[model samples]
Target chain A: MGIQNTLEGSNTEIPEIGALDVDKIKQDFPILQRKVYGKPLVFLDNAASTQKPLQVIETIQQYYTAENANIHRGVYYLSELATQKYEHSREIVRRFLNARSLKEIVFTYGTTDGINLVAHAFGRKFIKEGDEIIISEMEHHSNIVPWQILCEETGARLRVIPMNDNGELDLDQFRNLINSRTKLVAVVYVSNSLGTVNPIKEIIQSAHEHDIPVLVDGAQAVSHYRIDVQELGCDFFVFSGHKIFGPTGVGVLYAREEILETMNPFRGGGDMIKSVTFERTIYNDLPYRFEAGTPNIAGVIGLGTALEYVENIGYEWIGAHETEVLQYGMNVLSEIKQIRFIGTAQKKAGVISFVVDGVHPHDIGTFLDREGVAIRTGHHCTQPVMDHFNVPATSRASIAMYNKKEDFDALVRGLHKIIKVFS
Target chain B: MDELRELYQEIILDHNKNPKNFGELPDANHSSEGYNPLCGDRIKVFLKVKDGLVEDIKFTGSGCAISRASASVMTTLVKGKTVQEAEELFKRFHDLVTQSPQAEVNLEELDKLAVFAGVREFPSRIKCASLAWHTLIAALKEKQEPISTE
Candidate 1:
């Protein structure tokens, strides 16, 4: 390497690579110009949460502005309007997932709360003593601990589907772990930590053969892949709205109609009840039984809008674009010798996790921030995956619809500067 | 790019690469391990304390740059200091990394340790920078050979 290409011993100056037109994307968000550290903020933590577009924001505003009222039950005009709008959002979610029916879609707070609800309802009711729940090693703590609690309570066992050296789930091990005792198989459709797009369709099919229910944690998958609940044949599917560029405090859980009918209610309150008395309470049918309380009204509407926006753009183009950007990022980052790119899976989404030999991921993130580059530097809410990889943490860059090739170049230039400092 | 140069100043990288007082203390009187579960950082801190004075200090771990370098710099500063002095150093280091810069950290005494002050600006890395310090404190609290974060 030339002296200019080195961090210290070698020569490398991170080039003046540009990024997405903040001015253009900012036109959509209307929050990008705000100052942080007295500079333009580079928001690189998309995997944690995504920025909302004007359409989603406006949907929330419009909901409150024109169609704000309590839904279902009320006979008044405004109440009916709110009920129709709310139900319309459910249809959007149904179409988004290509679910069999709107009844399959149950709204919750987020993916964590959704998973916990299933653990409490489905896992608690149907799962018997000594039954097994298989999850991949790449699961976030949210996916792991709930089943752990379920197993402890039910005397069931929690089995792990191990990953190979490339951070991909080992199909052989997955098959070995599943048997007559296995009741549920919950796995991330795309790993948040590694960005590996799992073969969930095949995984779900195999589980179904054993009469085992599968729950695909689509928190990281929804934004990257085309999800069809029926096509995948998964018993249940869950994802957070925020991860798909929607509002926080909103999530969707899709369960088979029969499964939803069988599972008991998780929480008791208004709206979930069909008829209430001092002696006995009758629960509402389908989704309303699962969704108690007032719910995140505006959040759901905004999520519908977010879904509409994504559907308009189309997942095929988005997936192709993001995959290309990730490949380009890997190529650009490879130019810097000291940088060690992690998680090179065969089927990956837009995420790229890496480490520069001499520089820490935190230092790299901090340095990159100074140059208007944003990325995540941690175990990414998946500590077990980190342990599997035998790495403390890896700096992650996840691309969305808005990210461009120039963004990858800027990231490369930022890594070059990190190398310069460390070398 | 120029601004990033300031964040990853040469001194920080030097400490990261050829860390001072690196390695393990085989005959250590005290040791402890610290882990940042969120990031998977694991650091083992070893100390040789004789008559309330820290005669030797060392560390070993694989982590992000901030963590490994933090351990590296911590070992260099704590060695040859009294246990009480080491405790105070811990306090100073904590303030230097977690809190605002106004807190007095004894810059000359800090030497290479000062390079890590920039870490405070990045809130997520605070745990990485403090992993070794927490382990050292745990070691002192137990007054034994050591313990691990797990």
Candidate 2:
């Protein structure tokens, strides 16, 4: 089970009409061709990590097989080629987020890494005792724990904005939590557990009014639709490449050029510094200062391909197709009398968390696996969400572009079998 | 179907529905919590030891079928035995589940617990199946901190 994060979540709601050629798109992912337990795999765990396309898979294969060299510091022809490919991916990410410059787009291992980078660099420089950091209750452990550690080490305290019954955050509570000592507002763009798309623009506007920076944990929302950092005006945005059908290791941390320039380097390493003497060391420019050591060269390149793959297909159709599938899934699952859906937010993407009556999510997971249906069952690294809901665990079926109505049918069938067997 | 049935046997299901000794022992001298972080299953084991023998035992908290049943049956078996015998039983059960399927170690000597023999087939569920036993050890050992099966 994957337990992961943000938004450049702007105004793209599920429109009344748009569609993707999902059958054709499914062919692009080679793993979809295989079967598990003599049954065709109905993958519904996209929120955990997406199945990579052939385009991404081959790009990685091509990189290791032919173009393998350390980037940023190279003189030879092969090294130069590798550096260009690496930097080219950064430019691709910049365009994807519509960030002003490449200086703002820092390559990270994943969303967790990016969040930690901000926590360590920004927290050290700016946050001190009695200062406050505000986060919502529904944050993935990545977003919560880093701030918690920052609070613990720096003597700064953390404040939480609570969510209501429908799994939507109380904006009133969020606004109240913001006051004079509030250094930053860190919130997820889309909840990985609840699939609630946050009103990040409003949150950003509120925080900007107070001159407090906001970090949108966009790990879940990036692939759902297009994300424009400039449009959202968020100070920092972070997302994992793997969550969007790219390689696992690469992610993007889009700090606004001004904010990126303010923080110190997260880690000290070779490429992160411009020059180093015995007495002193000078760190590299804007994003590179944050990107220490040798980056995930192949992963970055593969993420570039994944982004291009999404671009070629178009986000409008992807959003509409996902909305339809999720709606159909909710409709069919609601018909089951025993099923109690968790995260019933009006706006959701790529996740359905639920618990069946007289059946534990763990058993449901085991039974589903036998039928070759893949779903996640656990806290999903959101213990607060589970605690607030008062369930030990939940069965989650998350979606991606490759999924269809048949996947929902298959899940409903597997659930029915579980009920029958238990009964 | 065979594996699924074997895993969720009638006895296991029955125990899961009506777990034995499922409560806290208010008079207990020793107690410890066992946590399966994977599923967020937590069970607190409370033992009343009198003159080196486990006079009474009970568990309180929640978990899945295999774990709940295992804890239920374990209380029934360990109630009358000495702490030494309980430890031996833990070793035997651990061997039964952790050993490769090809390695035949007979569980005929143990009752009800043999239902957990199927757990070795599903590697992920093995931790779920054994969390109670680990907690039992911690309780007997007088460990203060909660034990975690990470």
Candidate 3:
């Protein structure tokens, strides 16, 4: 029997909020019911990518089976239906982020693509030589590299906000870094490596004091909590679909409509232009101007279904369940005397990164895989975070809404077995 | 599975705990660095060759038990061998770690190095076992660029 069965049979109360039945919720993910190496699969690698539910899976299948057609500029019946579905997905994304209008939501390949677009389009138009772009030290490489490239191209300098030992960003130092020359503030809403949910509202308010625009990387935050772009007053926000139980190759870039209108196009192609002559080309409206070519139609529909599913479950229950699991995991793993927790910020999400005294993370990952427990062991695309911690890599276990206390139990068991072998 | 036991044998654990030639050779003439970027395992192999024979050899780095122990075992096997013999041994060792798990290995030829034959069962660790050997080869060729098993 699985850990869920064992826990349910015991006298312990499962501490669930509202209708957050984790056992019933786990039934939605078909992959979780399988066995790996004759043991039940315990997936803890949610930070890398979340597993798709049957709802999202069936949405994509239905799109391909009946509603497959190129969106926009089609005269046939199926084309109109496909266009409606694609636009409906955009509306869903706009509502999910609580943006001002559908014009503020632009579809892209993923978060990296969206960041690259802003770095190229906005940076080329407004930023000049001697300008500065501020980022944090704990940012993923995706958020750092594009700005570095933009700095290289525009002769702008990149400044970083340092982090404390507890993995929280030094907001005072961040305020010190902003000045007239600071063009924009690009920061992550929640760090994928450290699991630190940054104070983005305060950061945005601070930047606005200097009349500087801010771009929040919400790739790690959208799945953990609800986001209200209008309320945050950030100029731009970006997140990926795969990180939120949706399909890959689809993401949302929520830019203020006025700001998006001013930025130049990153890629120039068909459907993004109204009329193209040999001399000049007039661009399309707010969103289509940024989305150059044929977007991922089916993937967008899958994302809509995924967002609708999250809406039905509600963020309050999801957040409460995830917090409980995170606390339980920290308490269980703290029992290991040799384990050192890497990120101990009080305002953390479901991610827990730790390193054993004498064990390399790769070996720990291999041993855990044998026990049918999956965890990510590396820098997690945040090399600077690892460098700051003075470790090459770490073993990370991030929780999703579907995760339970039993998953942490299996992970702790696997870790104990690893310590035995290494000892 | 039993393959995990084969991969982490007693010999590997001993060598990992007390590695042989586990420091730098400041006076060495030839040296090269090898890095596995995936796991951040960096190794620098130093060699002192005189009259076509390996006069002295050492390595400096940090990695998993499999990699550190493989480097330790490699230094012991190729200490006094000739340059050509070392290259030939590298070929045999490479084949030993990369071949199918069911394939027959001549244990007498491999001698102490036979402990690494089980690495074939774990495909991801083949690069770990071969990192030191590749760095040694780069040292022999006097290549300036660091070898990376990406």
Candidate 4:
């Protein structure tokens, strides 16, 4: 109660606490060396979008500066060079996902685009009126709305697998939800609102048993963990590039080769067609048929460089570091009397969603911003999760490989100041 | 700190802590809901209109301090005033919060709602400050659908 921290009374200086080598990792990102409101930036909004390192940025710049040309069907040297770089990036993505072949990797705008493509191309071909598409209560709006549209368009029933109050999915209910009529099972790899690392591998296995294909929304999961599509046995895996320190406007969709052959093209354009007559047209091939029009060539190259950046710093090290930081943040923030976390699953990632007593999350977000601690404050595109918790929104601080213990300390300090002002 | 203090003034914080007329107006003629989909902040305004005057006004919802406080102060400021007077106040309040920095907003003109003048500094929160006022407009007209500050 003594020396209550108010808006005007507190200074925003964060004392530099020494860390061993995450500091070395942070040096790679140029935006990390930044000040907001004259305070050192404590960026905890990694769940929304990660800041790109210099490697990704420089690669993007190098592409535009030196090799800026259209790919596929150009006979010039520059066109061939750009095409090879673009193909090489696809090879990188194939290796990154451990897909069987480059034919499995198709670049899209982002995860949402990838999901929409599946909804159109796959759903139109396979799904019927009485068929069901199973999703979870913890899905982001991006995952839910597309299926809802597909259901409305095709008369397909959308079944939701319920979750407990702890934000963990009920696999029993999921097993019950699947029947002879269930066409697809799509679930998130990690809950963006609740940090719950879902058992998507098990979900995939259960769906595959019924001869159903599953799509894993790895948008939030790809940045933190190493994903192997072969090991996961998921039929389709989709993720965004910007979430994993890569360029925006680029993403990867990995499907089995045979499945790709069955699905029709999402778009009809120049690159996707082999032979076209006014009377008859034939689709080009596997990955190319899915990737229509001029793609984000520079973005693909930058994404390749970004994945290499993650590879150079192994996932084993990143995962361990994230666990340590998540635990440390939970410990420090739990000390406050008013703090109540929304997600406390048995297994969680670096994201922490909480509500403070008598204070709204938007207010918490504004106060924290003044202290230069960036955190996501909302339903996080998962309104159903917000409704399940019966709270309007949550103040979420999600961490990344570059985040350190001091970031949480800064956040704790900011929250204390906000609580004092409100109290 | 100076900008923060200007934005979170003592009046705004106090009203947020203890909002005025915050409940369901049991005998209300006009009602409307406001939603900010960006942050999921929601507010519902209820008014008992009588003889071209706002006899009573109340609100119930969850949002940031700026929004709740704005709604609270708005109820207090517009109660017992004529519908036309309240509409005029709404115009002044909107101008006070959304006016460009280069253009001067006369404080004495806004009276109680002048604290929201700080809101113009933050473009994102301008919608937050103006949500209740927009909802109040909808309530005045008895709009059936919810008003969204997208």
Candidate 5:
């Protein structure tokens, strides 16, 4: 009936799902059982937002029940416990991203908040009129609009790195765009719309040659592939915890220590200030400087648990499994007539975008959902990329480690129904 | 999957395939551009309003089926209606589209429009269905030239 139900012969064992227990993995997510029009749910919208696992959900509940108090200020037992766990979460994120220092990590709301932070703090301080901020045509609106806002405010110019027909970034255009006037290069590490894994390390290195800082939007990249901030050498890296099977409203902004110290604090409030008076306020150091309010305490703890879950699974093995699924999905979908796939870059995560002849994407999504399969059918938050590809929208099927061959089969079957209906 | 035919009605598919009034009105008296940055829906509403009446209405855009079909249904309903009557219809349509709790209307003429009532069940698609309605409202507001929703 579905991919997960049919994939039972694999020898590999998932942590709790048993021997190739794709069904067990599906069982861990409660929402999978949800009936949309009285049928099982087949969620293929991981690129938009991932469904939380049981461990991540239980950790959030356990946090509110066992440890719930104001962090950093209170000296009471609960507060101290909360503060320790909160800071420990920072350490966990630091380890997750392989950052050199815990002080480099600052918690924000999500990718949008993280980008705004860099814009407000970094753009306000260093970026001047006529300076250039380079970005890709394939970037999500979160990456594009913030830089536009920055440029509008500071009188800076925004430079775009164009994409080729394959939805891959034109590195030559990027190279040509990077002049001495370029102040920043903000690129999405893995495009949410195209699923193109950008050559960010090379992009960062090239920017560094001209002494410009790069901010990698790792919102889509973090869960798909392993990240080493030190290895990538990006100055500012941002990602949402929700994208990695954790809670929403909590994200990380990983900036190099020196670069972070150079920028001013985004918001001045209680935990972020060193000493406050009616007249003047001294700011706190490093990460605290950026984290202003009573941070999402439970959210931070839950994110910590999420990172732990990812680490336990081992990113390498997860990547391998997802690659297998991606390949299988691409191969299967390619065989379907009138199904034209977009974003055929050699290097990609588990994202497949396509448009079928004579069928609207919404019609396809509706038909698929009737059969308990869910997929995203829209511009996927990157209109400029869609414009580049000369299409208005596409149906996106993004997979995760839990997605097996049977899921691909189910999608193929759904597409077959869609084609028949359209014909 | 056969049940999906309920949502993607033949009328809607027909309209989406051969959209009504799908062209630019070069002699339009009122025009307005609408954009939904969330889903990247871009639409330009062109109205030939004269003597306080809508002589003709047209739209041009590339969006999901809900948006295109809704726009198609909207133009057909509003053509030849007075500006005042169209405005009232817009109010009624807005309430219907949003599935307002106090919605009170008969859907005899709004048959294709009634199909969009299912859009209310999907909150995300509500905007797609309403994009052209808002653009028409904008066109009514501008009443001359073209206004950008930037």
Candidate 6:
């Protein structure tokens, strides 16, 4: 509850607090400096994947140039150094989420991979026939499809928590949907498509009342806000590195130490097993049990640096700057008479989803692309949310810490150009 | 920028706004659906074919201006043509859109369909311009399975 208090600060200027210097932040990302379509690149597609900062890019380069060796099981000098750096990245992730122990942090490919791991290992072990799993209408396909596959495999029923017109989940309906047969509840911390920030603490607390575990898809949440897994009390939290300014093919899955211990090993291979016999195999300890293969060593190092970069900037400035930009974007976009916002949730992050009355989202996307303004257009991997809104697609502009007010101006100008073209 | 202007020509915009042969045909012998999964653009092409000649052609769906306009223009051009002629026209239109941006197009053969020649410059929108034509081919061949611009 106090976490919500931290996020609800007024938009008053605090010059002494060192307000986020977006121009300075933009310098860290080289891609932002490049031109697209002969115009300055205005990147608003942060929700899809964020651009890497110099720190993270250099971290990957340094890892490859210096400590390029296979981790774990090697006794040589470079191998020891590589293993130490890799595990140090794990500790970085552990601190990033404030998990109880290093054992609680497991590295995977990305958010999708982490969710699939839980669905397979935890679902096979705990979920049974006649059991029920609850998810929300706002979950991305990654969160929905894996559970659906799990339900099909285990003969469990998948129940959905409906949302209102504003894209906010109906907690009463959620409470009604859960019963004795309910095995687990999986939901998104921040909706990728809607930008709705669900009250995760209350959700986790409610699930705990029924003694049911909750898994939070934090793919869209981690980069924008500070995440303390211990404070949230969710059993499992998942996020992707690419969404948080890190390199792709690396992510973190934070599970409680006891819960991780209970679930079966996700994948069996060299690093995940202590000893393998012809007929019997003993799984390795908590974290390694989930990591089965030779991991993305350089990507992991890059992710560590990415997390450090965010920490150095501090969440307070990030949140405040994003809030100001989100307000500016909304205000500017609302000027267009044809604009109809899809996600009008009272509490939102840095996303604006809207559709023009007479124009298709794809057309809007192409027109904006010509102006060097990049925005996502489609169901955004949350097809169910699109179906709920009865729209084929919506144009989405997601903001980040590096986004400036001028970006919103360019976006509004782009929208005006699109409207004129369609008219 | 010139290519962008060519892609969204006034004719394409007019066709998108007032699609000539828009809606379902009640007495259609052949019908097929075209879908672009990337952007969820769906168009159902309904044709009234008799003696291998298309008596009437119509389409109903929702999509970008390029897709809707392409379907509208295609229905107008293919309405009194034989199945063979329609198939030939489909090949020409496909070539016109997919050809390299710098390639010289024989616009005399394409006629009104030449408006879509600008799609060559914006490679991603080429599928949007061709979805309806592909669906028309599927209908002409009596293929029951819906075609997709994957």
Worst 10 residues of 5 chain A by lDDT: A4-13
Using DockQ, rank the candidates from best to worst: 4, 2, 6, 3, 1, 5
List ranges where model 6 is wrong by over 4 Å: A1-19, B143-150
Model 5 clash pairs are A3-A406, A3-A407
lDDT of each candidate versus the true structure: 0.80, 0.88, 0.89, 0.90, 0.84, 0.89
* TM-score to native of every candidate shown: 0.89, 0.95, 0.94, 0.95, 0.90, 0.95
In angstroms, the error of model 1 at B50 is 2.5
- lDDT string for model 4 (B30-78, tens) is 8999999988989999988889999999999999999999999999999
- Candidate 2 per-residue C-alpha lDDT over A46-151 given as tens digits, one digit per residue, 9 for 90 to 100: 9999999888888788788777889877798668777777777888888899988989999999999999999998888999999999999899999999999999
lDDT of 2: 0.88
Top lDDT: which candidate number? 4
Question: In candidate 1, what are the lDDT values of residues A35-138, reduced to their tens digit?
Answer: 55565555666788888877787778877877788888789877776676667779889989998888899999999999999999998898989889999999
Candidate 4 CAPRI classification by DockQ: medium
Selected candidate, larger DockQ, 4 vs 6: 4
What's the C-alpha lDDT at position A344 in model 5?
86
State the lDDT of candidate 6 residue by residue for A46-126, as single tens digits: 999999987788777767777789999789877877777778778778888988898999999999999999999999999
lDDT of 5 by residue, B1-150 (tens): 333454567777778788999988877889999998765678999998889889988999877777888899999999999989888878877777677534554679665467766665566677888899999999989868643344
* Fnat for each model: 0.96, 0.74, 0.48, 0.93, 0.44, 0.74
Candidate 4 off by > 4 Å: A1-20, B143-150
Interface RMSD of 1: 2.4
TM-score of the second chain, each candidate in turn, equals: 0.84, 0.92, 0.93, 0.92, 0.86, 0.93
> Which one wins on DockQ?
4
Position B109, candidate 2: lDDT: 82
What's the residue-level lDDT of B55 in candidate 4? 92
Q: What are the per-residue Cα lDDT tens digits for candidate 5 across A178-246? A: 888999999999988778998889999999999999999999998988899999999999999898888
Which one wins by DockQ: 3 or 4? 4
All predictions: root-mean-square deviation over Cα? 9.9, 6.0, 6.7, 8.9, 6.4, 5.9
